[model samples]
Target: MKRLCKKRELISMDLTPLIDVVFLLLIFFIVASEFKKNETILNLSLPNSASKENIVEKKAIVIELSEKKLAYKTSEIDFVQLEQKLSLLQKDSQLTVKIDKEVKYKRVVKLLDILNKLQLSNLLLITKSQ
Candidate 1:
């Protein structure tokens, strides 16, 4: 009598290798991205939260304001000078304003108004957490 042959499984796929490749790519992006380029001059005491996403990949020219003075990047610049530089730079009007916690609110508002007057469309305000 002839013995019956066992049927083999037709469909089979390995996910382990694919998962490993994805994991490696994730790690590569994390490592390749730079978190900070220069010593962030903005004394923005950023408000803390339960969770905060790391600001990476998106590099923006930093502008800082303090009760003591106003500045672009690290260099101290007057409002007129700032405007001139802004025009010269001719970069995106969108800018980030890093303000000290102790600074007056009116000052911040005034800054926003000036940015608007300059037609700067985007403004990011910085604040500190209690």
Candidate 2:
């Protein structure tokens, strides 16, 4: 008498569901991510310049000068406070001055003077292309 042999089924994993889950997660993150814009909340009429080069630096210190008040980022700050803040920043940190066209010339000069005194080398002036 011969003994009958039993056939064993091969085990396999279906990866279609895994792939679908991964793709769904990717889509969710893409939709949830925020995109930064060049537009600022502060109303500013930027000066026009012939230069077209746009340089963006990491951890840039932005100082906005409007006709009425000076702002460090979004909060309004005084000149002395600005100086104190600048003094705390690293020497290599990039500084971007965004001055409104209607702002007084003396205000710009004062800010420049402070920057000059600090000896911050990475300085930039934000202007619109004409």
Candidate 3:
């Protein structure tokens, strides 16, 4: 007698579409994420230095000084306001100072004076890498 039924083949699912969808979602998330841009409010021509050290502190307070204005953590502030805000910080608190390359010497001196008076010496001066 002849066999009534033929052998059946196994069915398999294609994974190419699943992988493509996952990669597409990954690319979408990568493109959608926003990176933090430090001191984006001011157009600063930062002075360049040859040193390659990146000593950014996570908890440091940022002070940005441009030719026409000064900003503390992105908010425009005057010298008195700066002094007041800085005075509230601990002596050991880290401070990141970003001064424009075109800023006047007197302004830098003035900022140094305030820092000196406060005795907040944990300072990091941010400069562009050469």
Candidate 4:
């Protein structure tokens, strides 16, 4: 009697389902994610200063002043409208002002006067750090 040997086959995994699930998750996140808008639209050069200390505040109202216009959260507004909007904010709410380097000093003084009237003492001036 002669003895016979049996041949063995290699096992492999099917990764098609795994790849499909990964692609579906990527698509879902891409559709549900929110992109941040560019906050600075005005072509104004910011002044630089050598300051190491920085303060970060949450939920502060941002006001941007350019040579041509004033902006609040990307919307161009006038002084009257800005005053009305600021009037609605809480007396202690923090305010951040981003004024262009070339903007006149009087405009800044005017804004400061408005803030003084509203008594918004928590103010932050945004400037570039050198």
Candidate 5:
């Protein structure tokens, strides 16, 4: 018989696994990106300060003073329970105060005095810039 020559062939890589991994990563990032959008809005206005550091407000004792009466959070509170209320609030976490513009300055000062007596050092007064 005459001599016969066989041709050699190179193998190619399978792309099925690589394609599957790419699809999984795309789905994961899409889900994560959607969750970054915030849902609720805080209607209150905040003034700018020279210090650019961020101050996080975890919780606060809102004192809304209208022309009618003084209210803490939602309910009206007398000076007697003011200390107890603040103490109770302090037991769980830190707090700040959000006072309205129309509120009397004297009332705010009195509350500050009480807070000092309770030994609560950190106090933030919320106000709008004119």
Candidate 6:
């Protein structure tokens, strides 16, 4: 008499589906994220405004000003350098100024003066809603 032999099949899991799911999730998150280049660099307390007008901003240049620091976009610079940068922009370019509430009036005036000399008339001063 002869004894019969048994054979077992090897089991394996396909990781391709798992990898695809992870890749899709990564792509979804990347597309949904908002990247702010300059706004988060400085802490500012904007003054309150009583006016109810809501300004809808299109593509515009951003200038952040604090008591001790002035930033063009995200890079910290002095008034002279800021002026030079502003001069290169078009006269009608929309400029958005975000100044700290604690900043002195003199500094605000100085910035306004630079904008005036450059003849950049399209200006928007950002403030908090009361």
Root-mean-square deviation per candidate: 9.1, 6.7, 4.6, 2.7, 7.6, 3.9
The digit string of per-residue lDDT tens for model 1 on 1-130 reads 9999999979989899999999999999999998875645545555444544435225455678777677787788877787777665443545666777667888777776666666776556554433
> Candidate 5, TM-score vs. the true structure?
0.47
Query: Model 2, 45: alpha-carbon shift in Å?
Result: 0.2
Best by TM-score: 4
lDDT of each: 0.68, 0.85, 0.91, 0.86, 0.61, 0.89
Residue-level error in angstroms, candidate 1, position 55:
4.0
Model 5 clash pairs? none
Q: Rank the candidates by TM-score, best first.
A: 4, 6, 3, 2, 1, 5
lDDT string, candidate 2, 46-111, tens digits: 999998777777567788899878888667889999999889888888887889998898988998
14-122 per-residue lDDT for model 5 (tens digits): 9999999999999888977845332112333344445544474645556544433545666676777767777765543444555555556787677778777888766
Candidate number that wins on TM-score, 1 or 3? 3
Error of 4 at 113 (Å): 1.6
Superior candidate under TM-score, 2 versus 4: 4
* TM-score of model 6 (CA atoms): 0.76
Model 4 clash pairs are: none
Tens-digit lDDT string for candidate 3 (67-124): 9899998889999999999999999999999999999999999999999999999999
- Steric collisions counted per model: 1, 0, 0, 0, 0, 0
Q: What's the CA error at residue 33 for candidate 2, in Å?
A: 1.0
Candidate 3 stretches greater than 4 Å from native: 1-38
> For model 5, what is the alpha-carbon lDDT of residue 36?
39
